[model samples]
Target: MARMPHTRAAAHPRYEALLAEWNELLRRCQSTAAAQEDAPDPAPYGRELLDRWGEPQRRYHTLDHLSEVLTRTTELAAYAHDPDTVALAAWFHDAVYRPDRSENEQRSADLARRALAEAGVDADRTSEVVRLVLLTVIHDPAPGDADGEVLCDADLAVLAGDPASYAAYAAAVRDEYAFVPDADFRSGRAAVLRQLLDLPHLFRTPYGQDHWERTARRNLTTELELLEA
Candidate 1:
């Protein structure tokens, strides 16, 4: 499989740019009532999520990762039923990430549920956003889940990165789990790679299936071999 260039997620954005992206997405998709005099400002929520992404504990799940998925999602927006809605889910998917925690996705989904409702996102869209955030826990979205397919495919696109980019991704994941011993990390990492390899398909969108699948599998297999070796 021929490798592709890295995702723009690797490109770091200025804090202001990301904040503006969030604010714009929120306002564009916000419920009609969100514009009322009593409505809470959405900017603050965007800033808070950015702050969490910038936290000292994060390595791989940083703002760079967020931008990459957002960019990829935008590129695949043609496949989504509601692009901005799925975009919002990408913002909150790792908003509450903590490397040692197993419940980060749940926590992130809860955060989206509370923040979006308070910020005046419509109930139905908010629910869908929450559902998408949780979907990352299992990168499989059922058939015809257009929005889910876009989000999941964008999130996992890092797997199809060129060798240097994939190496960086692997190194960053190891850095995130720096607390774990070498042998333990090797076993755990190998298990994760194996699980991904076991999946019938690494991507769901037609574009993803055609473009990312082979490269992603090759990258994952190479990394798995290194860990087991």
Candidate 2:
């Protein structure tokens, strides 16, 4: 069957104009946020690779994840002592994510440093950004500074979110390792969940502790049960 062209010319023009306006809004936001003293100009140094593949096929750590983390980090920063550094840390935490690579954090931090240099951000601030990005490793969550703690908390905030969002996050994580066997994936994932449950508190921030600790416990318990079963 032949497809009809969009028949309402005036309506089509209006819709196209609206879409252009919406895109402009997003561009301005990214530019403004990236230009913040704390935020590195996000233009160069690694976007082409992600964009080369196009959307929908994009993996777990897309610009969407960056935006969400940034938004949460901003909120959490209010409670933090070094809000600027925390915000910068959030911007670069996942600046370089590769599911197949084990050195993602290190690589992301490198990219962040380069961006910071290009933006003329201070050397001390760049070093702090690097430290904050690496803290996401979670093998040892001993964040040396308040900014690091806030960034770490923001990154994992989804884990303590509503069950629906938590479930979605779990699925996305599993998808990140889709090549792995289901049993192996479950075992590895359950280990991480167990670690969170065993923590004195998964979140150090008072807000996180209050809002997320209980829900995170419940989710961890449930997920662990599924793994055991």
Candidate 3:
């Protein structure tokens, strides 16, 4: 019976679905925290995050991207040590996105820390969520970091999409940085592609590596060449 935020975006079809999922995830994670008696209802927080993802300033990091990441995280849940926590991390990963900012991941992690603690989640689980959120900054989870692998692989799955889908993702990213000059955008984008390409393996999970690594590599390489050309 939590009151959803008073916002126009709350009327979107998927808003209801995501909110339900968010509430369920909070319950599941909090249950592992031993079920705090007076934990606040999580609907309001979910509404706030949905509103942020639907913000006009965002192009690529929209609600659709959030949905996709959540879906992928669920698919890769079996590989995570704490699946619910990894799913929670996916919720906050891009919750504070702004294409102009370089500290989005850190900021998002801080936000998760404050919000989860306020919602009565335990220190250890909240800390795990924060740590996973920060992992998206480089998408480089260390060896044997199961939760990190799941979250980063889910977030980066867009890179392994079909050619048309990858092209759309690239275009949407450009739209997000519409303020940057073309020359600056190209160089910056190329650097990003290079860094991702240089990773030992773009995905650490067996499922992610078997299904996505080659396609992601090809897509990133093609985009990098286009930028340099």
Candidate 4:
């Protein structure tokens, strides 16, 4: 794997901590892939993943977002049928992001499938990872899809974070779409927020429903009002 420059400094303890966790997740995923079959090493793929997450164009969907999803996955892992798979999904869900692209999720899923296969992961598990990545597009998993529910909920967990963090996230998202004209960006963003608001439940996992639903609604409502204004 090509080494990417480590731009994050130790002064940011949270970024350092998340980097550590990201490394551990990569190690665990590599080990699991190795157990499936003897093939090309997965470490390089993991490095590539980290590099992609560090892309300069990303704002809200950077390594910080990945780390948050991974953290939430850890908290909700107990409810997943295969926690490892869910974690893997979280890692690659936004791996191929592009603010102007409609195929980001599809491309990300394809990347997950190819990388997992190269890592020697079996077809079924790889397929599941792809499915989980695709689920992020609409964030609607089928009923009783425990792993899907966990991954999706974790991905959206930031929506329920504290007001300051949520504000930062919203700003970052706007920055990602900075290429768009202000009025267009506001209209598109408002549409997306309304769609989320229309959902019967913003989160699927029992843990998410119990802990995040109320706050997530409050946050979304607040953002939607601002966007509409």
Of the candidates numbered 2 and 3, which has the greater TM-score value? 3
Q: Please give the TM-score that candidate 4 achieves against the real structure.
A: 0.88
Candidate structures ordered by TM-score, highest first: 3, 1, 4, 2
| Model 3, residue pairs in steric clash | none
TM-score of 1: 0.93
Instruction: Compare candidates 1 and 4 on TM-score and give the better one.
Output: 1
Q: In candidate 2, which residue pairs clash?
A: none
Better model by lDDT, 1 or 2? 1
- lDDT, candidate 4, equals 0.83
Which one wins by lDDT: 3 or 4? Answer: 3
lDDT of 3 by residue, 1-229 (tens): 1334445457666889999999998877664444647667787778888887787888889889999999999999899999999989998998888888999999999989988888778899999999999999999999999999999999999999999999999999999999999999999999999999999999999999999999999999999999998
Please estimate how well model 1 matches the true structure, expressed as its whole-model Cα lDDT. Answer: 0.89
Candidate 2: stretches off by over 4 Å: 1-58, 139-144
Clashes of 4: 0
Tens-digit lDDT string for candidate 1 (1-229): 1123223322345677998888888888778777774567667877787777777788899988988999999999999999999999999999888889999999999999998898888899999999999999989899999999999999999999999999999999999999999999999999889888998999999999999999999999999988887
- Model 2 poorest ten-residue lDDT run: 1-10
How high is the CA lDDT of each candidate model?
0.89, 0.64, 0.89, 0.83
Please list the residue runs of candidate 3 whose C-alpha ends up more than 4 Å from where it truly belongs after superposition: 1-8, 31-36
Top TM-score model: 3
Weakest 10 consecutive residues of candidate 1 by summed lDDT = 1-10
